[model samples]
Target: MAETGLIQSRYRLIELIGRGGMGEVWRALDESLGRQVAVKRLKPVGPQHDRTFTRVLRERFRREARVAASLQHRGVTVVHDFGEDEGVPYLVMELLDGQNLSQLLEENEQHPLPVEHVVDIAEQVADALGYTHRQGIVHRDLKPANIMRLTDGTVKICDFGIARLGHDIGMSSRLTTTGLAMGTPHYMSPEQISGKEVDHRSDLYSLGCVLYEIATGAPPFDQEDAWAVLVGHRDTPPEPLRTHRAELPGFFDRVVLDLLAKAPDERPADAGDLRRRIVLGRTGEQPALGPGPLARPATGLPPAPRAKALPAWTRSMTAGRPATGSTPPPAGRPDPAAGLTGQWTAATATAPRTGSSVPAGPPAPDLLATLEGRHGAGIDLGRLGRWAEAAEVHREVAAERLRLLGPDHPDTLATRYEVAYTLGRLGRWAEALEIYQDVARARAAVLGADHPDTFVARYEAGISLGRLGRDTEALEVYRSLVEDRTRTAGEADPETLRARHGLGVSLGRLGRWEEALAEAREVCALREHTLGPDHPDTVISRREVAAGLGWLGRWREALVAYRQVAEARTRTLGPGHPQTLAAREDEAHCLERLAQA
Candidate 1:
């Protein structure tokens, strides 16, 4: 067994992050680079298990490493290193900084996610699956716990332990007959449940189950009996999403239902096709009714096939609890630091000595770990929207970090950044603005003027200025930020486009409607090209264009823009969502103005 602390003379395992039937994941440091990484160590099977089972488990671990390392996409986890240490296999990966959907659902007390969030996740997961499917990989086990959403809003699909390459039919066949089902019962597809041939469409069906659960707080089949759940996947039709959550967008409901089609051919043709459907739906450009099986009434599903004995592999399967089944840690318990950056190590806790450029002695590792744990707790509070408590905790941690590691230390600055963020969330814009400026300057000096962290702080400062109605100051901040972002990240980069969008908003606030309209148009076109027309950012830019046109008294043109925004928002975010209603209000106001004109 791999114990805590240094392994392979390079990685120092610090704390356990997660564990499952297969193995345990640890937060560890790469002693070579002084950076943190996650190490997933395969658990050893006892002699009670057949030798073949042990061999298959090791093979799966190696396969996960190979498949994950081969993938290169923003929506997939990045594998850093993999090897065996003392007969124990471990895979090192970039430590993600946010919760998985299962954790997010648990954090929300099992309530359904916001309509917009559900749509966003669906689109992102579809895009990722499209990329993987094109590479001839099928993730046989796509579950909520196997995906992650980072703190920065990037969604990544994780774990390919059970994934299969399309070209490797021989190995796939052997693996399938190992007397174990390859997928979680709750999310398994009909073909997967029946032990039949599976393909990329199976992944789409699994994604449908995930979306259903997050959209309705329960999977399509929520029965406690494993056999019954498999039976439902194999035979029963799922209830429509809106029947459980009335506010789910109609387009979203249709897309998800189509994915849940009983036969593989009845579902969307491929992941690419699925992505296009989501885009079309979000843009309000989809057909009034989808094609093929999607056009059929939900009740028109063919009757269940005649009952037959289920595959023998299913007999050993357990009615596994949903990934979201675990409750949050009790109020006083130490929260698990699963999504933390893992940067608070002794190597990083150096302070500058008085009147010297030489670094001071490193602080105690135990103290650093404790503070890091507290910092994670603060982040969890923020995730729960307890900004007041989060602010207090971050402030305390920032002070301690500053005293121990110096003002410009990354850990100290990180805590301070959270403090500023929570302050902004609490509507203390002035205080937030002050702290953001401080952090920006510090990060620029310590990291670099063009560092991403520095840019983030500067961007937040502009947001603070805008919230305080300092349009001129906000405009200047965004103009400079746009220039820097364009130079560093390129004009087509999302961050650059985001900065330009902010500039356009500031111009409109300053009554420069013509300039605002031009900026918004440019940003909208770039965003559509780079992020697709249905992306939330692109839609926001489109709305900005409408706002600018209205401010310039071009009510006729504004009405067209407003109506498009309203329809898109309605299709993607549901008709009753606050953003959708606001868009509708804008459309109504535009009609009134056009009539007056």
Candidate 2:
């Protein structure tokens, strides 16, 4: 490749950033987009090499580049473009302005990284593994040099679906007759050394080696000889992580050990589970993984969702409009002194109401339409984050519907449901609980107990119960709802699955972690099969599995699960979304657990 020239008339090579056995990585500019990019220039085969081998290499390069380009994720490096410039195949990727783990270790003078940073990186790598494995792609080579950590705290795995080229094509002659030394020997798994089939588990083992080195300042078997390192991976049991760093968290120590297991079966099930363990380990010490207390139950009957007090709706209205003692009423408006209150006289006879009727017929037909219009306006307000205004509008509509259509009317109950939702959005859990219960009861009576509308109301009631620390009540509600939903809509319905998810959450809250794990795993599998793994709801179910694993004292698996969720949420939803941040928070909590343990 030319030293300082344009490639394909689009990528202008600026300077060589790094070089490896297979290629040189250059800092370059994408003239088409006015952005920086990293250009990988594959080493050219010698003129004397067989045509068939060169053709095979070029084909493999194109196939791998295509696979890498197909990956659209935050945890994997983004490939911008790929092409051949004068027989030198090149790949253009998003220029990462951060150091790889190898660089970080060197910057730290070959010392171990901070415990928090080590766990964080472990979580990220595990998450990336989950995504890649799900796509039926194995990284084949995972080492410190292939993992990059950005300045914004984003960790990405590079050379996805293409690292094998470095070993298989670029350095084929370096391989011995026995077929050893395909990947960095320090991080190679036992199966890789034995020249047997490898899978995602092999990547886990390699990641273990990376985690061990980052946490303890050296790989598990840091032999100077490459062959000895390969042999050590196959035959030798690694020394305990604590042996090198006694101050390291015991939870982390156990996780690293599990990852280093020679047999793939002995490792965590997958990256999802690994992240979950990390989350649980870090947060296990807490009574609850998050805010919100579980309310104590009342005697006898199942604890009813409580309504503590009404929100201060009047406060906002009266804040700056205090009445003056001497203020007079506006012109033509009824004055208090002019009314019967001043004379204190009772009327001798009630005035006849001319327009009043004996029968209280259904409210004027136009009232329903007017109420619906107001309801829509309230929904629009809520969407704009004006929850207070929305709540007031919903409250007024609900009251009017009750007065005109009766408590059991679907429209009235629906309005009440909205009021509850708005109250919850305003953090008025008690008020929300009251309204949700009333709505649920009314809906159950008007529209059968198993009706979808009733189920929705009941679901909201359960959410309110959970918010007010009445998780036992919430659990009971969810359990009953699940059974009802299964009977009504079958086990595979999304609503049924939702109820099952709630039941799992409630179980977790009650500290029945083993039961919770079973429930969560069951729901996750079903969701994966029915909704697809990448669906937001399915991702949530996976997160629950991690939570259950963490609570069950499986820190390593929990860490993996949490990391997978965090990464998925960051991909499907933006990193700044509340759900994504929640996943990230769990990951951080797991790291903290490892640090303290």
Candidate 3:
């Protein structure tokens, strides 16, 4: 049991309520919200595991937690928050007063649950499974212990602890042992037991096992030896429910037996259909239990790219250890940017190109192919926050492109542009400025002076100049780019507004307070009209307006602007986001200035 202490300086631990080999659960108070929550802390892997295993486990944990928290159905347990404290990762969930089905079974001296109770659980579990499956998430682990029944008769599925996106095969394949599986063997589906691709049907198979145990006083395939149980699940057929309990409903037996089908296609098409069968079975209606209407496929956006694993050298500099599992940004500290994206997003305001561009002259195909791989490797390095290593990779790729495609070729310039980006991230402003200017010049010659790519390079040059304390040069770059962008992309275009916003920043840096304030107001207005008030870009412009107000000694107006930005960020990105924290810092600075005045 963990000693009583505060978690993340906010959740005050009251007592350890549950324990497992890999984690412990605590009843805790959310100091910020003044509410009780259940906190589950995953024990850090001991040195017994190699670094590779440890890293994989950590990534799996975080991914599952985030996926669990995003689920909004009532049949699912609520995930309030998740983060790390003192190097131990923890997940904060809604505290529920209920007994899991396993405990309920234990309370009854291992006898099957009452028939009505069994039906209710099956219905609720099926409903929850339906919701999760539609989101393309598979609960890899489903057992009696993971299904909870509240005293109010509400059943919620718990522990999405090992759940993963259906399409995520890379990590799953790595974690699978030769004979052993990720889930409990007795409850595991045949496909899962064989280490084959699993889908929503796997959940159906696991649910079948749970139902079988609760309805028949034991799992359908129970044996004293674990290996025998695995063999029975794979090769032997389960005895019909009537054999164990002659009084059980015939429809219930059919549903459970159908779920235990060896082939995925043989099971009910989805959990929703399974629930319909359970609900209608209680009525006189004939439940459509066999291969009914298939559930709608997952329509959610493709999963975001996983954060690149940190290489050995840069791990120390990447602030605080990466939690073994999903760690929510501490309250009010949302990670709003990817890698150096926050710094370069506005400066390089071009959208990613999805359509393939024909090369100027079919470039050396083999060299181009190799450069493509190297380019991705460089990007992966950057994502890991290894700026130095990323810069090196980009430099090598840029040199190779220069030799094969020439310096003026769009592909070559693109590689050089990435090199400059890494340089800027490393705070080598002077070095970055030279490369940015070179890329801008080359792009202008090849792609036209006012092209979006040309404008993007000039925008970065402006940012580099500003970083070097050369505000006049930076202002010139932004003024020209903003005018060109407004003409080409329209004033309402986000890229144009980005340039206008940069112009405002330059004015503030030059101590042109009045002009900066006006420019900030104008850009903020344009962004609000185009991007909505809650957009990250809009809030960022609003922050600049607050800065201009402070620069002009308008402390009252500055305080209000800063407060608004902070509140907006809290709503959109959560209060603990870095942007929200920055806004709070500005608010504090304004307060200090007001006191002095």
Candidate 4:
């Protein structure tokens, strides 16, 4: 529940403007500054809720404030202040006089926006993205609803809730532990759909989706089913824009299509390049073509990168219904305008009522929503490193889901998967191994042997085997997983290289020094090429190369590798960071070994 008046004794809430699942936005008067502002207040989590979930939510709210407040661009929404009122977090921002693109579409009856308006919005967004990317920020969740058009035609990008700072890999990884892709299904890049590392290029792909929708009155993939939409993004080449709207400029169509390339490398090199191309196209100059749809022979463009499997988590995702003025709310629901900004309605009516009896059949939708929230709370606890508490909550959720959804249900198996991961974190290797194997089998049966989720479980099973000192078994698991990953995701894919790295480690554990060295070198080179030389995964592979060199009695070469890892870690993670210190320790040991020789 939100209060109606003054908060923090400084800002006065005047009227409710927007509401979302997590918070509500109010048109407020900043008494101290004598100005009007939009104040977004987080919905308070009751004491009955998991304390860990409540804490994580507060942290995320604070992060969004910090990230948004740090930016000072005209094409981005400006943050004024942030504070907590009565234990509820709130953020204050500049209020715009016009609606977001989603609302504009709804107002226009879902017709395509004017072509010139579309081009103007694209250029403004590209310029903003260029600034943000240069500042090392990647907006992971970019959609039409998150971009706004002011009354004066100024365009701004909003919502930094899931944005990732380039230097904060550990924080980013922890925040995403809830097993959900951060972006909307229609806008997700192929790499994002397949659970691969995403960079700024992912934002470009999402912008392409936004541009396509505004230009053609629908998303590039307009499928009703969420799975179908995700598959379309992963495998299908979008129909040319001219196919839907004949009046769209050829150069503009080519630009949007190029941004939608399946491979990040095939897209423009950066937002700066994208902006330049847009500028060139607007001025009647031809932009240089790359390997995108525009570079094709005009007969057809190459198909999207074909992955043999999609992540299983996508199966449970919903196709986010686009907002439309024609569709009225059902009886007893609030007006759509009440929930304008977040593009999602509150879950109040969807959760099971307290003190109510559940029927003894299939679980009710309300009960399922409750279970899902609790499951997410469990994940949040794990993200905070409370493994014992996380394990307890996950076990409880897994049992409930199993009873209601059956052993083969994806939800039940997903909960069970979390339970196993927590057990491994708690050092219960044998128990974790058993659960991992079971989940892998169940997922394989349901989602096929080649599904990414099944492969994820199998990969963890290998880690558990290794932790239990069953090196031979771990080696076998990694070898099979590497082959499958290579066949499905391609050899250069990050996941495939990860499996190969595991195989190399297992070989070293079995004292196969020569084979481990070769495998390590190859995987290290590939990781460097695919993930960048200083990425954490590439650094890990480089460390493995050093370990292989040392095991092969190449002390001088090992020393060089160890020193390189140490220097890279120091540069990226800072000299005082634990990982950098560990790298330094490795270098010292290498020197000691060389001295003894």
RMSD to the true structure for each prediction, in A, is 28.7, 22.2, 23.2, 26.8
For model 4, residues 79-148, the per-residue Cα lDDT tens digits are 9999888878999999889989999999989999999999999999999999999888888778999999
Estimate the lDDT of model 2: 0.68
* TM-score for candidate 1, residues paired by index: 0.50
Residue pairs with colliding backbones in model 1 are none
List model 2 lDDT by residue over 279-398, tens digit each. 777765322323211222233222211211111100110111111122343343223233222211121012212442212543444766788899889888776656667778988998
Q: Of the pair 2 and 3, which is ahead by TM-score?
A: 3
lDDT of 3 by residue, 86-170 (tens): 6777889999899999999999999999988998899999999999999988997899999999999899988886687877653
lDDT of 4 at 495: 71
Candidate 2 vs candidate 3: the lDDT winner is 3
Clashes of 2: 25
Clashes of each: 0, 25, 13, 0
> lDDT of all the models against the reference?
0.73, 0.68, 0.71, 0.73
Candidate closer to the true structure by lDDT (higher is better), 3 or 4: 4
> Per-residue lDDT for 494 in model 1?
73
**lDDT measured at residue 227 in model 1 versus the true structure, 0 to 100:** 42
Query: Candidate 4 at 254: error in angstroms?
Result: 0.5
Residue-wise C-alpha lDDT for candidate 1, range 381-407, written one tens digit per residue: 876645667778999999888877777
Runs in model 2 lying further than 4 Å from the true structure: 161-181, 285-597
